[model samples]
Target: MSEVKLVLSYKETIQSKLDERTKELIIHAKNASQNAHAPYSSFHVGAALLLSDGEIVAGANQENAAYPSGLCAERVALFKFGFDKRDRYLVKAAVAVPQIKGENLVPPCGACLQVFAEYRAMQSTPIEIVLVNGSGKVLIAPDIYTFLPFAFTNRSFKYFI
Candidate 1:
C-alpha cells in the first residue's frame, strides 16, 4: 500500500454567484425536495445530476415504513441515472438539503458517497459535487473523491471471475 495525498479545494459561495448550469442544478434539486416523502424525519432532501448529454435528472428522498429501506436523495438520483444511462457520463451532481439553524449543509451519507465513488470510477472524467442549503449557500467540490478520501474502489478488493 502506498500513501496518497488528498487535496480538497471546496469552494463556498452564494447561489447568485454560481454559473448558469450550477444555478440551474440547485434550482432543480430544491424543487425536487418538495416531493420528498420524509414523513418520519421531516428532513426533505433532493438531488440532481447533470449528464454529459446535456440532460439533468432529479430525485427526492423517499422514506419507507421500514426505516432502513428508505433512500437518500443522492442515491435516488444517481440510481435512476445509472439504471438506464450507465454509458452517459455524470458530469456533475447537486444535492439540496434543508438548512438547519446555526449549521451548514449536510454532506451525503457514507452509502451515498460509496455509490458516488462507484459511478466516478466507471468513468474517466471526474464528477463535480455541489451541495446547497436552503439559505442559498453553496459548497462545491472539484470531485466526489474530495468528500471520500479513502473511497473503496475496484482495486481495493480482488475478485475471482
Candidate 2:
C-alpha cells in the first residue's frame, strides 16, 4: 500500500468584500437557519446551494424524535437541487449556523461530503463551499474535496478495471 496526500485550497475573507453571489448565499443561509426544525439539538443550521442554471436552493436542518431520522441542512439543500434539476450542476454551497453567542460556520459532515462528491463527479467540476460564521466572516473553499481529504472516489478503483 502507498500513502498519498491531497491538498485542499480555500480563501478567507470578511463579509464586506464578498461578491454579490457569495453575499446572497450567506444571506440565504442565515435566513434559512430561522426555519430549522431542530427541537432536539437546538442547534439550527442552514444551507444554500447555487446551481449552474443560476437557481438557488436552500434548506434548514430538520430534526426528529427518532434522532437518526434527522437530516442536515446541507443534504436538504443538495437534495432539493437534485429533485428539482437532476441534470443541472451545483456550483457552490454555503452553510451557516446560529448560536446563542452569535453565528458560526460548520463544515458539512462526512455523509454530506460523500453526497457532494457524487454531484461533483457527475458534473466534472468542483463544488465551492462557503462557510460563514455568526460574525458574518466568510471562508470560501473553491472545492469541497479540500474539506474532505482522502475521500473515497471511484477513481481509486480504476486500476481494477
Candidate 3:
C-alpha cells in the first residue's frame, strides 16, 4: 500500500476573479436564485450555464413535497441545456448565492459533480465553473476535473463486459 494525496486548489475571495463573460453569467444565476422553490430547506440555489453561442440559461432549485424528489439548480440548468442544445458545448457555468446568507459559497453535491464530469467528457474541451455569493465571496474551478479527480467517466466502465 502507498500513501496518496489529492490536492484540490481553488480561489476563494470577495472579488471577482473571472472574466467578464463569467461575471455576467453569475449575475443571471443570482437573479434566478430569487425564484427558487425551497420551502423545506430555505436554501435557494441558482445556476447559469454559458453556451458557446454566447447564450446564457439559468435555473433555480425546485424542491418537491417528497424530499427525495428535489432537484438541484446545477442539474436543472445543465440538463435543460443538454436537451435544448445537444450539439453545443458548454463553455462555463456559474452558481450564485448557494449559502443561506452568503457567508460561504456552496459547492455542487456529489451527484451534480458526477453529472458535470460526464458532461464535460462528452465534449473535447473543458467547461469552467464559477461559484459566487451575494456577499462577494467567489470560488472558481478551472474545470470539472478540479473538483472531482479521477471522476467516473465512460472510460471507467469501458472494459466491462
Candidate 4:
C-alpha cells in the first residue's frame, strides 16, 4: 500500500470586493438564509447557484423532526437546480452561507459533498463553490473534488454492472 496525500485548495477574499457575479451570489444566498426552517438547530443555512445561462436559484435549509431527514442548503439548492434544468445549463458557481450571528461559513457536509460530486460527474464540468462566513471571509473552491477527494459515485457499483 502506498501513502496518499491530498491538498484542498480554495481562495479567500472579502465579500464587498468580490466580482459582480460572486457578489450577486452572496446577496441571494444570504436572502435565502432568512427563510430557513431550522427550529432544531437554529443554525439556518442558505445557498445560491449561478447557472451558466445566468439564472440563479436560491435554497434554504429545510429541517424535519427526524434529524436525518433534514437537508442542507447546498444540497437543497443543487437539487432544485437539477429538477428545474435537467441536463441543460451547467452550474458555473455556487455560494453557501449560514445565518448564525458569529459563526464562520464552513464547507458542505459529507452527504452534500457526495451529492455535489455526482452533479459534477453528470455535468462533466466543475462547479465553483463559495463559502461565506460571519467574519467577512469568502472561500472559493474551483470544484467539489478539492474537499471531497475520495468521493464515491455510482461507478462504485461498476463491478455489479
TM-score, each model? 0.91, 0.90, 0.90, 0.89
Model 2 residue runs over 4 Å out of place are: 1-3, 100-104, 154-161
Per-residue accuracy of model 2 over 86-119 as CA lDDT, tens digit each: 8788889999875633444578899999888878
Residue 145, candidate 1: how far off, in angstroms?
0.5
- What lDDT tens digits, residue by residue, belong to model 3 across residues 1-161? 99889877776765556667777888899998988999998888999999998989899999999878989999999899988988788898888874545567788888889998898888968888888876878888878788888888986888684
Candidate 1: give the clashing pairs: none
Task: Give Cα distance to truth, residue 66, candidate 3, Å.
Answer: 1.1
- lDDT for each residue of candidate 4 in 17-56, tens digit (9 for 90 to 100): 7888888888888889888898998887888888877888
The prediction achieving the highest lDDT against the true structure is 1
Better of 1 and 3 by TM-score: 1
Taking all chains together, the TM-score of candidate 4 against the true structure is 0.89
- Each model's RMSD to truth, in Å? 2.1, 2.1, 1.8, 2.0
Report lDDT per candidate: 0.89, 0.85, 0.84, 0.79
How far out, in Å, is residue 100 in model 1? 3.6
Evaluate model 4: give its lDDT.
0.79
Tens digits of per-residue lDDT for model 1 on 1-161?
Answer: 99877677799988899999999999999999999999999999999999999899999999999989999999999999989788789999999985443338878999999999988887857899999888888889989988997788775676433
lDDT value for model 2: 0.85
> What is the descending TM-score order?
1, 3, 2, 4
